[model samples]
Target: MDRTQYLQQFVDETGWYNSIVLGLILPEWIWRPLPFPLQSWLRNYIGGSLLYLVSGFLWCFYIYYLKRNAYIPKDSIPSYRAMKLQIIVAMKAMPWYSALPTLSEYMVESGWSKCFSTISEVGWPMYMVYLLTYLVLCEFGIYWMHRELHDIKPLYKHLHATHHIYNKQNTLSPFAGLAFHPLDGILQAIPHVICLFVIPTHFMTHVILLFCEAIWTANIHDCIHGKVWPVMGAGYHTIHHTTYRHNYGHYTIWMDWLFGTLRDPEDNYKKGE
Candidate 1:
């Protein structure tokens, strides 16, 4: 099959998956019983923050407590204690930072959600197009925002620099993923917010996307040396942290490769490889 055909299939399958999990399953078993505000976007934003902590801790525990290895050669700079502290600060700050975007969807339009009923009523091909278009736009925004963070010195020093503290070898942990300064976090996240306003996105799809994003961020910081073909993975991100000049794109390497920032992971030293 051609690239377009392949993408369509992938989007259709994932849309169905999101409809079931985020729409039907979550509302029935998880969100419905929540108390008042807890059942709203407040729940999603707060839960997303908590999800960050839980996912980060699991990765950190595995690397620092279990495996005791990093994808890149271990360097000494930020200590585990420092990493822990940054995670605490970032987690506390994330809810407020995430809220701005989530809340702004109302300003754009209503009835944009892909709830179970909506998904069931809509055609998969149409749903696929919406999902694909939304993600591509968001990814484009993420690429530029991430690249600018590294390119602009003032921005780097004031906002993005805190994130690079983990650039030093084993100094990175899952917690190091969200260790971003609040401004940096917001800038990187603006794309998702913009998507909600510009694209016809479903509430459940948006929630699931954000949740997966948190997990993906933590996984990259863990530096597991796994690659997912065209998709950038922990190995891709580890290169960005270690080399400090390549792989600036998130989710996919297409942007980085197109812009001449992509680096081969084989060039980097991985533990026991």
Candidate 2:
């Protein structure tokens, strides 16, 4: 059998739509009684806020309290005051961050974006291709958007600088992940929406990827090196926080390496000594 035939066979065997329906059940239930546009915005805000709070708390509890000795040094643990400030900033930005997804969903519903409802619409082969393309586009867009937030003085001073307050290990934590100015957080996420217009995307997959940002950011801000190659793990992000001159890539270090701004975690350790 050829590639297309093999993909068709695979798709036939996998009931992917069932998983998508399962994921949407809760959101649809919550949205049932709410009005249309308001429901879109309100649901996203509430869901995003809850995800941030729960993920941030669990990660902080596990790493900072449960595995404190294994992950963070005694002096390097972020203070309660710092974590509180991070939470406050993140909560303030949550509503604004939620708007992007609401708007994106509107666009998708109105047939503005090339977002498809099912994998079979494009066939499994093209589904995989589009998915990969969407991710790459998002990665590329985020890298440049993030880099500009630092290179452009006004943008950094007014927007991105809020996140840089946690410039040291002791000041960083899971809570610090979303501690960006409202506009800054939205700006970084605009890429995900942009990709919807650029190519075909599975609606549910796109939504899941957007939500994954919350988990990814929390993980990256934990200040513990996971030592995963190419991934923009906490080790690399820590260098970005301190030096502010390197590793602006999101999701991965490929963009940083390609654009000549990549810095390894060991470099920061050497400089500190």
The best candidate by lDDT is 2
Model 1 C-alpha lDDT per residue in residues 146-230, reported as the tens digit of each score: 9899889999999898888776556766777777888888789788777865766654576568667777787777667676788
Q: What TM-score should be assigned to candidate 1?
A: 0.74
Could you give candidate 2's per-residue lDDT for residues 1-273 as a string of tens digits? 554564443233222432243236555566546555556677677778888999999888998889978989999998899999999999999989988987887677656777777687789999999999999999999999999999999999999999998999899999988999999999999999999889999888988899899999999999999988889999999999988999998899999999999998887678872
Cα distance off (Å), candidate 1, residue 1: 40
Model 2 scores worst on lDDT over the 10 consecutive residues at 10-19
Q: Which residue pairs in candidate 1 collide?
A: 113-202, 113-203, 114-202
TM-score of each: 0.74, 0.88
Question: What range of 10 consecutive residues in model 1 has the weakest lDDT sum?
Answer: 108-117
Q: Each prediction's Cα lDDT score?
A: 0.68, 0.84
